[model samples]
Target: MQIVVFGLNHNTAPVEIRERLFFAESQAPHLLKTLRDRGIRESAVLSTCNRTEVYFCTDNADSSLAAIKEVLEKHFDVDRRILEGYTYTFRDESSYKHLFLVASGLDSMVVGEPQILGQVKDAYRMAVHSNTTGYLLNKLFHKTFNVAKRVRSETRIGYNPVSISSMAIELSKRIFGELHNRKVLVIGAGEMSETALKHLKKEGLSNIFIINRTFGNAKKLAEDIAGIPYPFESMSDLLGQVDMVLASTGAEKPLIEAGLVLQIMKRRKNRPLFIVDIAMPRDVDPSVNNIENVYLYDIDDLKDLSQKHLSDRLKESELALGIIDGEVAAFSSWLRQSEKNPLIAYVIDKAEAIRVKEFRKASQKLKNADEETIRNIEALTKAIVNKLVHPHVTLIKQDSDREISETIKRLFTPDEEDEKDLDNRNEGQ
Candidate 1:
C-alpha cells in the first residue's frame, strides 16, 4: 500500500477556507472509522487550528482521496467546489517527506513551533484508539517523532519567538510600551490561552483574569497562574475592565461581538484594547476589528511576526533537514531489505524441495546397487545441489549492491507451475 497525505494548511489556504474544512477533535474517531468502512484500510486525521490533514495507507489513491473528500464534505456541510480550491495531495516518498517536515515544525506558519509535534502525537494516539492505524502509519509517525526530537535537540529552531502567543504578546508590547501595567484578560482555559498567559506573565504582567464555561476549570487555571477567576456569566462585564484580551474558548459562536466591544470601549473612555483571538472558530467577531481603539488579531494576524524569525530558524532548519534526509534514506534501505526477505526465503525453500524430490526418485532405482554405492550417490547429489545453489544464496545474502540483488531476485523466483511444467516437458520428450 502507498502512504498518502491530503490536506490544507495555514500556508496553503486562508483561515476562511480552513475553517470550512476543519474537523473537530471529537469527530476524529468517527471520521476515521467512516473512512476505513469506505475501504480506506488505514487512516489518521490530524486536525488543528492551522491545518486539517488525512494520512492513509491505500493502494487505490484516487478512491481513498475521494472517500476522504466525501467525508470532509459531509462533516463540514460544505460543497466539493469549496474544498477543491484549497486541498493538496501527496503520495509515497513525498508524503513521508511532508510529514517529516511537519513534525519537525519546518512546515508550520511559525517555523520551529513545538506544539505541532504534540498535536501530531495526539492524533496518532486517537488513530490508535480507534483501531485505524496499521504498520505503515505507525512506522511513519514514529520516525517523524524521532526526527522532530532530533531537530529540537541538535538545532536552535525552537529558540526564536515563533508561536502565535509569543507574537501576540510581542505585538502588544509594541503597541502598549510595556505589558507590566496592562490589565490582561484570558478567555478560556485552553492550551493557547495558557501559552499566552505564560508569555504575558514572563513579561511581568501581574493583572490577569481567566474565565471559562466551567468555574471549576477557571479557578484551577487561575490558581495555577495566580490570576483571578471570573464567572462565566460576567464575560461581557469583564471585557471593559481589561486593556488587553486573549480569547481561545471552545465556544461555537463568537464570545465577543462588535457591539459588545463598542460598549466596552465606551466604558474604558476610548482607551485602546489589544484583542487576540486564537481559537479555531474565532472567539471574537471579525467585524469588531474595524472599531476605533480596538486592535483585534487572529491566528492569521501573527504571520508577519512569525516570518520575522524565519531567516534565523531557516539556518537551524537546514541542519534538521539534513538529519531527516539521512534518517529517511536509512529507513528506505531497511524497507527495501525487508521486501527482499520473503522472496529469498521462497527461493531457498523451493530449491530444497526440488533437491529432495530428485533424490527420492534416484533412490528408487538404486535397489540393485550396494548400500555403500547408494550412500555415495546420495552424497554426490547433495554436494552438486549445494554447489549449484551456493552462488545464488551468496548473492541473496550479500545484497549490498543493487545490481547483484536484482539479479538474484530475477534468477531464483520460480514460477508457480515451474516444477510441474518441467516434469511434463521431460515426459513428452
Candidate 2:
C-alpha cells in the first residue's frame, strides 16, 4: 500500500476558503466512516484552522484520490474546479515528509508555533477512536510525533515561544503603545482565547473580561486570569468598553460583524478598537476591519510576525529538516529490509531441508560406521551448510540499496519451487 496525503493548507487557500473545509471535532468520526465506506480503509482527516488534509493508506492511489475528491466536493458543497486549484497531492516519501514537517510545525504559517503538534495529536486520536488508523498510519504518526518532540527538544525552533497568541500581543502593543492596565475583552474561553489572554496578562494588562457561550467556562478563565466574567449576551456592551478584543470562538458564522462594530465604534465615539481573531472559522467578519476606528486581524493576518524573524527561523528550519530527513531515511531502510524477509525465510528453509536430507542419507549409508564417525560426518555437514549459506545471509542482512536487493533476489532461487527445480537437476546429475 502507498502513503498518500491529499491536502489544502493556508499557503494554498485563503481563510474564507479554508474555514468552510474545517472539520469539527464531532464530525471527525462520521467523516472517517464515510471515507471507509468509500473504500478508503485506513484514513485520517487532519482538519485544523489553516488546513484540512486527508492522509490514507491505499494500493490504488488514483482511484482513492478520485473518490476522496468526490467526497470533498459533496461534503463541502464546493465545485471540483475550485477545489482542484487549491488542493495538492503527495505520495510515498513526499507524503511522509509533509507529515513530519506538519508535526514539527515547519509547515505551519507560524513556523515552530508549538500548537500544530498538539493539533496533529488530536487528529490522530480521532482517527484512533474511529478505528480509521491501521498499521501504516499508526506507525507513521507515532514516528512523526517522536520526530516533532526531538526537534523541539534538540533544536532552538521553539526557543523564543512565538505563537499566534504572542503575535496578537505584539500587534496590540504596536496599536496601543502599551498593554498596561488596558481593558481587554476576550470572546470565548477556549484554548486560543485563553492563551491570548494569558499573554495579555503577562504584558501587565489588568482589566480583562471573558465572555463565552458557556458562562461556567468563562467564569473559570476569568478566575484564572483574575478578570471579570460576563455572559456572552453582553458581548456588545463589553466591546465598546474594552480597548482591545481577542476573539477565538468556535462559532461557525461571524460573531463580530461590520454592523456590530459600527454600533460599537459609535458608542466609543471613534475610540480605537483593536481586535485579533485567532479562530479557525473566524469569529470576526472580514468587513469589520473597514469600520471606523476598528482594527481587526485574523489568523492569517497574525502570520506577518513570522517574517520579521525569518532569518533565525530559517536557521531553525534547516536543523528541523535535517532531523526529518534522517528519520525518513531510517524508515525507508527498515521498510526495504522488511520487504526481503520472505525471500530470506525461503532461502534458509531450503538450505535447512538440504542439510537434513543429506545428513539422513549419509547416516543410512554409513550404518556400519562407529558412533564417533557418525558424529564427525554430521558436524562436517553442518559446518559445510553454515559456510555455504553464510555469504547469502550476509547479503540478505546488509542494508544495501534496492538495486542490490534486486540483484540478490535474481541471483538466488526466488521461491521454494525454483529451489526444488535446481535440486532435481542436481539429483539427475
Candidate 3:
C-alpha cells in the first residue's frame, strides 16, 4: 500500500476556500467512513482553520486521489476544478514528511505555534475512535506525535507565544501602546479565546469581558480565567464599553455586523475600537473596518505578522527540520523493509507471540512476585526473543534467496500444519 496525502492548505488556498473545506470534529468520522466505503482504507482527516488535509493508505494513488476529490465535490459541494487547482499531493516519504512538519508546527501560519500539535493529536484520536485507522496509520500518527514532542524539547521554536492570539495581542499593543487598565471584550470561550485572554491578563488588562453563544460555556471559561462573563445578548452593550475587541468564535455568520458596529461606534462617540477577528468564518464582518473609529483585522491580516515572526524562528526551525528528516528516513526504511518482505513481519510476530506466551506462563508461577520483578521478567523474555530472532531476520534481509526465505519461514512457522499453511500462502503469492 502507498502512503499518500492530498489536500489544500493555507499556503495553497485563501481563508475563504479553507473555511469552505473546514471539517468540524463531529464530521470527521463520517468522512473516514465514506473513504472506507470507497475502498480508501486507513484514512484520517486533519481539518483546522488553516487547512483541510486527508492522509490515507491505498494501493492505487491515482484512483485514491480521484476518490478523495470526488468525495470533496459530492460531500462538500466544492468545484472539482477548484480542488484540482488548489490541492497538493505527496507520496511515501514526502507524505509523512509533510505530516511531521505539520505536527511539529513548522507548517503553521504562525511558525512554531504550539496549538497545531494538539489539533493533530485530536485528529488522530478521532480517526482511531472511528475505527478507520489500521496498523499503518496508527504507527504513522504515533511517530508524528513523538516527532512533535521531540521538536518541542530539542529546539526553541516554541519557546515564546508565537500564535494567532499572540499576534493579535501584539497588534493591540501597537495600537494602544499598552494594555494596562484597558477594557477588552472577547467574543468566544474556545481555545483561541482562552489563549488570548491569558495574554491579555498578563498585559494587565483591567476588565476582560467574555461572551459566547452558550452562556454556560462563557461563564465557565470566565470562572477558569478570572474574567467577567455576560449573557450572549449583551455582546453589543459590552462592545461600546471596551477599548478593543478580540473575537474568535465558531459562528457561521458574522456575529458583529457593520450596522451593529456603526451603532456601537456612535455609542462610543467615535472612540478608537480595535477589533481582531481571528475565527475562521470570521466572527466580525469585513465592512466593520470601514466604520469610523472601528478597525477590523481578520485572520488574513495576520499573514505579514506571521512572516515577520517566522524570521526570528528560522534557526530553531532548521533544527526541527533536521530532526524531522532523520525520523522520515528511519520511518521510510522501516516501511520499505516491511513492504519488501512479508516474512520479516511474520517472523517478528511469531517471536512476539512466543515471548508473550512464555511470559504469561511464567507469570502464573510468579504469583507473589513484586511489580519490579514482573517487569524485569517481561523485559528479559523480550530481550531473549529479540536475540533469538535477530540472526534469522538479518539473514533474510541480507540474502533474498527464495530457498533460504522458505527455510526461515518454515522454521518460524508454529508447527507442521502451520508450515503447510505458509507454503500454501507463499504459493498463492
Q: Which candidate leads the pack in TM-score?
A: 3
Off by over 4 Å in 3: 163-195, 198-309, 343-429
Question: Model 1, 229-256: lDDT tens per residue?
Answer: 9899888777888889888888899989
Name the 10 consecutive residues with the lowest summed lDDT in model 3.
420-429
Q: Relative to the unseen true structure, what is the C-alpha lDDT of residue 57 in candidate 2, on a scale of 0 to 100?
A: 85
- Where does model 2 exceed 4 Å of error? 163-195, 198-310, 340-429
Clashing residue pairs, backbone N/CA/C < 3 A, model 3: none
**TM-score on alpha carbons, each prediction:** 0.53, 0.54, 0.57
Task: Say which candidate scores most in lDDT.
Answer: 3
- Given candidate 2, what's the lDDT at residue 26? 92
Inter-residue clash pairs, candidate 2: none
- Residue 136, candidate 2: alpha-carbon lDDT: 68
Using lDDT as the measure, name the better of candidate 2 and candidate 3: 3
For residue 60, model 1's alpha carbon misses the true position, in angstroms, by 2.1
Ranked candidates (TM-score, high to low): 3, 2, 1
What digit string (tens of lDDT, one per residue) describes model 3 on residues 1-429? 789999889999999889889889999999999999998867999999998999998878899999999998988898888899988999999999999999999998878888899999999988866767765787799899999999999998986545567777777877888888999988988887887788778989999898998999999999988989998899889998999988888989989888888898899898889998889899888988898777788878786666656776887899999999999999999888687886876687667666767787899999999999998998799789879999998999899998999889878887888777656645644
